[model samples]
Target: MKKTYDVIIIGSGGAGMIAAITARKQGKKVLLLEKLPTLGAKLKATGGGKCNLTNTLSSEDFMKSFGKNGRFMSTAINMLNKDDLREFFLSIGVQTDTKDGFRIFPVTHNSSTIIKALEAELNRLEVEILCDTKVERLLFDGESITGVQTQNEKFNSSNVIVATGGLGFPMLGANGDGYEFAKELGHKVTDLYPAMLPIYVKETWVANCTADTIAKAIIRVDLKKAKKLKAVGDLIFTSKGLRGPVILDFSREITPLLEQYEQVPLLINMVKGKNEDEVLQHIKKQTALNPDANVVEIVSTLLPTSVSKELCLIVGAILDKKFKDQSGQVRNDLVKIIVNTPFTVTESIGFKKAMITRGGVTLKEIDPNTMQSKLIKGLYFCGEVMDLDGPCGGYNLQWSFSSGNLAGHLL
Candidate 1:
């Protein structure tokens, strides 16, 4: 739309929108380019369309959850932190509330509300937005970014923010163009994986219990000897494999290991509160009280009937056998299976089902203080394009807004 602008941001996702708003707030001419006709397509689908805006964790705790690369986000996060994010939304006329004491969402409970609010803010700020505009390449002059080029023409700008997101949700227009741009510019892109997707297990029996959820299931992944990765929460059964808060959270760790092992082993603690011995004794006590009851019926009280039946099959226990008729070895085997149900993870459902991308442009190339490129001046990166992914809830959105604002502030 313009021959030159103060800031031209690629991709109209959360980071690009925030960057546009922040740059405009500084009285800079901003033009936002979107690949899709509609803006914020992925943002609209986040948190099942409610748009989890930010989390309620303390700043220190919040950064810790993101792992080592999170330290790079310290300055950006501190500059426009969670409180600032919530306040920004409130200032934009979107009142926010938190569910589960952490995940913050618009009180309206509709993601369109957020998109509307952002659009209104951009309109009020006079930031230009061009939809259905695909940026084919970056127009650079060796060390500094000059602008971006589409098929028909080149839009010139000294400052260009590449917020094209990651390889997650490709159908929503995230085609990894941002990573390609970074690679073309001599920046290193890390190995990418599905960050927050359900894992597919080799056991087909788990698929049959699609209606059942393993509440309070403790999921553990085998690491090197004498070490293991562990997470505790509910695991919801899916037609393909496993899904839920715990499985989604555990997926971050599970994906990297999946790369090396043919089958990543995951052990589930089906009965949460009891140890192997405690659960065995509990079963013995139950059998003593009702010796005539079927083993399936007794175990069903501990787990879902479908799951219990499957577990019995796995442990060589006959569901029709009375509890009193079951041998000690059968009892021990059943207890072991209940305490530690093993599943071999074949792979994740992949980017289509993944809520976020695990890796992107390496952290060292971008200055966290400003989100500007260390190698290429006037070029900035933010959001899922960076080598940063957080746990489920609202951390990723917060990172997007914070990093975008930081870049815009410094721009």
Candidate 2:
């Protein structure tokens, strides 16, 4: 005889675990399936293993961060905002702290702490968890979910939540299984793109600046159509190109453009938003104070020695000469480079290095209020498997927990 559950959740990532816990808390016979032998493999890698659980932003501001489709997260966030999530963690004997005063993480600063606590709570709640179980397909009876078929057996459930996350970290068991299931059920899966990853640029000079991390750098797309796309954070030059907080956030916009254009030009303000005039004035002040200072030393006041030298080379300024001794055109060009260093991005590192997947099942077929599928009764969706994605800083994880909570309610 096939065992039955009131609610069956596929995948045991954050969303799947949370959904199982929520359903079991309601006294429903809940079962969680995971293809991986261990649960929360990707969650363990979140925030580079610190596990940023959520943030302190208000629901309105939080929704705005996800952009236009962010409105779809209103009900979910309203039900399980940051405060609620913290309280829930506290209930399970896990402490959290926000040292940065915005991003939240377990006090231990280890993702294993959060995962272990959740696993303990799930065990305490008597939720059935089957690791190493691969779900082949959702059993849909045309208009409703009947159950799910695994490689070895069939589990019967009227309500099933497909919390299988998107393909981001393939090494961590991400395979786009949720998107496949959604497509099989007649849901529209949006074009998937690898996001939150480092990009390789056409300029090899960036290799020279790889040792220094520019703080508060501003990066913006140079294209007229994408003039509004910009991000501000710490920027790191890499052997291949650029990475760090700013590039990871802005990569979401660039990857989609990469699908259309051969190369994407970027204007990076490495001098912390200083304009040409401001940089020139700073150089002038430095030169007046130290007349012997060469172009490298003068520019090094605003940038690292390596970066300063690289910029001087780009503008063809003599390194050993005083800033005033440089040709007028060279001086102007140097200031422009100081304000906006140009890089032509040729390629992204792709899914292997991406932190998240940009597109998944379209939101049009899913109810944001309950996370239930509008096309099929008793079918629900949650987590990164959905079309919506947000920038770093706990937005994606918060969305997973909130949507899972809403989906588990079976409302």
Candidate 3:
């Protein structure tokens, strides 16, 4: 006799766990599989282990964050939104709160709190969890999903939800296995690209600014035949390259251009909301008021010492020369360096460092309302497995939980 479950969920990430819990709540037998030794391995590492669960953004603004692909998630999010997610977690005994009005976190501020709460709920509901169980492929009849094939055994289920994450943090078991399964079932898997990842640049000065942050830098990506893309937020300089909210948010657009071109140029406005004329005029006034101050000193008044010095080098301005002694051309050049700084992109640190992938199972094949595959009956996809990636600050997890919740309920 073969062991059969009412629902078989592949991968024990956020989406899979939620699906299992939901199905179990519906009085359906549920089996959750994880390739890694521990469940939610990658999820535990999110938000530096604080586990940013969801955002407080309005439904419309929240959906826009995922780009055009976000519209595909309308049904799922409408069914289980941020408010509903908060209520659900509270019901499971995980208290929640918010910082900065948008990012919501566990009241305990520890990711383990979330994992433990989910595990406890699954236990209470009698959901079966199989950690260290690698699901290699799906077992299906020609008409629908019949079960899943693991290394040791085949468990039967007409309802199978692939919540296996995309090819990010592979060491934590996010290996794009779900894409293969989708393709085998005749669903189109879109070209995958890394999003929310740092980019290696040709600017060597970025190393000197390592661990330093430009509080309000604006990043603009200029791609061939494509309109320039821009994002504004705090940007941190890393030893290897650039990393931070602004860069990560723009990474999805950068990845494809970097692949096609030898090097894509990234324009950075170090000072937000300041035009070239305004910045240059301000520098002139500052130089006149403090004639004895060196050019570097004058720049340091407006920018960090490290960044000011680097900008001086880029503009070929004399570091020790008094600001009053500098030519007007030098002042204009210095202002341009700060207002229109550019970095030549080499490549994005691939899937290993990516927070999420930009592409996966094409959205058209999955019903937005149910997260069920239109082609393969009873086969569903949710979370990063589908072609949806949102910006930083907890948008991605919202999609995972919402889509998983919708799928589970529909099943």
Clashes of each: 0, 0, 0
TM-score ranking, best first: 2, 3, 1
Deviation from native of the Cα of residue 76 in model 2, angstroms = 0.7
Write one digit per residue (lDDT tens) for candidate 2, span 125-167: 9999999999999998899999999999999999999998888
Task: Return the candidate ranking by lDDT, descending.
Answer: 2, 1, 3
Clashing pairs in 3: none
Off by over 4 Å in 1: 223-227, 288-292
Number of the top lDDT candidate: 2
**Model 3: residue 187 alpha-carbon error in angstroms:** 0.7
* TM-score of structure candidate 1: 0.95
How far does residue 180 in candidate 2 sit from its true spot (Å)? 0.9
lDDT (Cα) of model 2: 0.93
Q: Which consecutive 10 residues in model 2 have the weakest lDDT in total?
A: 11-20
* lDDT string, candidate 3, 289-328, tens digits: 8888898888877778888999998877889997667778
Error of 1 at 162 (Å): 1.1
